[model samples]
Target: MNIIQNPDSTSLKRTIEQGTADQRIAVLDIINEVRKNGDAAIKAYTEKLDRVSLRSFLVTEEEVEQAYKEINEELLTIIQEAACNIRDFHSRQKRESWMTTQENGTILGQKYTPLDAVGLYVPGGLAAYPSSVLMNVIPAQVAGVKRIVIASPPQENGYLPAGVLVAARELGIREIYKMGGAQAIAGLAYGTETIEKVDKITGPGNIYVALAKREVFGHVSIDMIAGPSEIVVLADDTAKAAEVAADLLSQAEHDERASSVLVTTSLSLAREVKKEVYKQLEPLPKSVIARSSIESYGAIYVTDTLDHAIDIVNELAPEHLEIMTEDPMSLLGRIRHAGAIFLGRYSSEPIGDYFAGPNHVLPTNGTARFSSPLNVDDFMKKSSIISYSQQAMLENGRKVAAFARLEGLEAHARAVELRLEDL
Candidate 1:
């Protein structure tokens, strides 16, 4: 990992840019082809990219039941526990319709409505993630979305992973499709003979999938276009060097482009953590990827004070922030930008990623500055409700008509005038 005394503002800005125009064009072509060819395009692309030919895409109830028998009882128990935790947390974020009535007999309110159907894209094959299944599906269930469909790439054997199937079945989601990449996104957005068009799509995928989501956004609602995973550790002398090093490597192992950075006031601790990272990396199974990530994007920035470290964190707006200090909670209010905040030495990044109730699908590539983590609200929509009594319209109609005429919208003025003509 690179060690810098203090990085300038320009260098910080350059690290967060995610995708290129060429990538966008490539994904756009894939979306267009899928739109034109429909189910045939999806099958062709699945064969070319995933190296599999599929006669059918949907996972049957028999397959789901068989998956439960394939996996161990221990893992099944763990997945159930995680799902319960996720459901409990998101249930708190559920909203209710509300109304207010005035003495003039006018009623105003807001109605919360869940989307009719939602498409969830889960990475398949060797990169299967049951945690993602729980995180994505539970929130939609809490929001009362009835139709939840899943799209995942098929393995070499033309089947989804047992763990992935088990997770979806546990959530009572049986509509699993054997497709992935940009084509899966297209099928979800535009619909094919086998797949139904969904109102909203949510999940994380590679660069192609991200670009496809960007292309089909207006046609169908989507969650944020996520970038590579990133983590920023803010520490002081009180933090343990070994624990911090392990946490940094946890995110670094995600991908070759994933970022793991440490900003601290203690220079000696920074040096020690750097050494610990090297020691921990030697035995990791994904050492090559983690090493590349650490060498290219990882850094240790030594600041003058903890306040300076916090300032750097806010500027970076990392997806995950860990504060390891004498009093971790004391610095909570000082943090203004971060998708998920982990405090103290014990609160590592993976705790929130897997077991904790909070959603792991967070904003990436500095998007935490303005956006937020995926929640129950992502699957829901809101509509304004207004009811006007005859007396109320008679009392205010002419004023509305005069204001509309001032804006040169004569039709709007006439609409109000018609309501008040009898008065």
Candidate 2:
């Protein structure tokens, strides 16, 4: 880790992986093949890429039972408890259809409707994240989404990870698919023989999966084009160097492209955190990845004051922001952008990732400035309600026609005028 007196905009800017031209072309090819061949194309890709041949992509009840046996009762209990927390948190975000009456005899309102079906793409191979399952599924379930599906790549043994399966089972998510990468995205976006199409897709994957989401966006709704994991620690002199360093490395180990930054007012704390980051990274199992991330993207900025540090944080709009200052709550009003904020040292970033009940799937790579964390609202759509009484239509219909004609839409004007004449 490097410590600088005052870092500039370029130093703070983090880059996300945008797939290469070849990868994009490959993704398009896979999508097109799936659209044309459906199940056959998916099977071919699974065999070629995953090195496993399968006649069916659906996970059978027998396999789900086997997955339960593979995971111990203690870990299963933990996953169930996490699911309850997630469900409870998202339940508060549930919305109901509402209407308001006006003096002019018009009813105006909004109707909230849950999406019929949604597909969650959990990453497989190298590692399996049961946490991702709890974070993504619980919100949709809370929103009353009837059909929730899980799609993950199968290992060479032709089975999804035990943790992944166990988590899905705990959530009562029975529709599981053994597919991965662009093909899994394609299958979810466009219906195949075994896998039905979904109204929306959410979850995270590699560069290929991200690109596939971009390609299939308009066809079906998507959460967001997520980037690599990121963390920005806004600390002051009161913050401990070891605790801050450990928190930063928690995100850096996620990927070589992951970013971990520290913005502080005290120069002493900055140097201490920089030293502590290296000392902690030495023994990490993913030290090579974390070290690469730290050397390439990590930085410690020593600002003249806490206000200046907060200004820099707003400018970066990082995915995860940790405030380890003396009074973390006091700075809450100043923070304008962050996917998730961890206040105080005890409220570490991992708390939100696994068990704290907030969705771990968040906007990344400066996207927090405009987007938001996944919640129940993401699984629901809104429809505007409009009912104008006869008297109300007679009063506003002419103005509506005039406004439509102002845009040179003759039919739109006539449509309103025709109703007005009847009124």
TM-score of 1: 0.97
Q: For each candidate in the order shown, give its overall lDDT on alpha carbons.
A: 0.91, 0.92
After superposition on all C-alphas, the RMSD of every candidate to the true structure, in Å, is 1.4, 1.2
Residue lDDT tens for model 1, 223-293: 98988899999999999999999999999999888999999999999999999999999999999999999
lDDT of 2: 0.92
- Over the stretch 84-139, how does candidate 2's per-residue lDDT look in tens digits? 88888999989899999999889999999999999999999778899999999999
lDDT of 2 at 182: 96
Once fitted onto the true fold, the runs of candidate 1 whose alpha carbons sit more than 4 angstroms away are 13-18
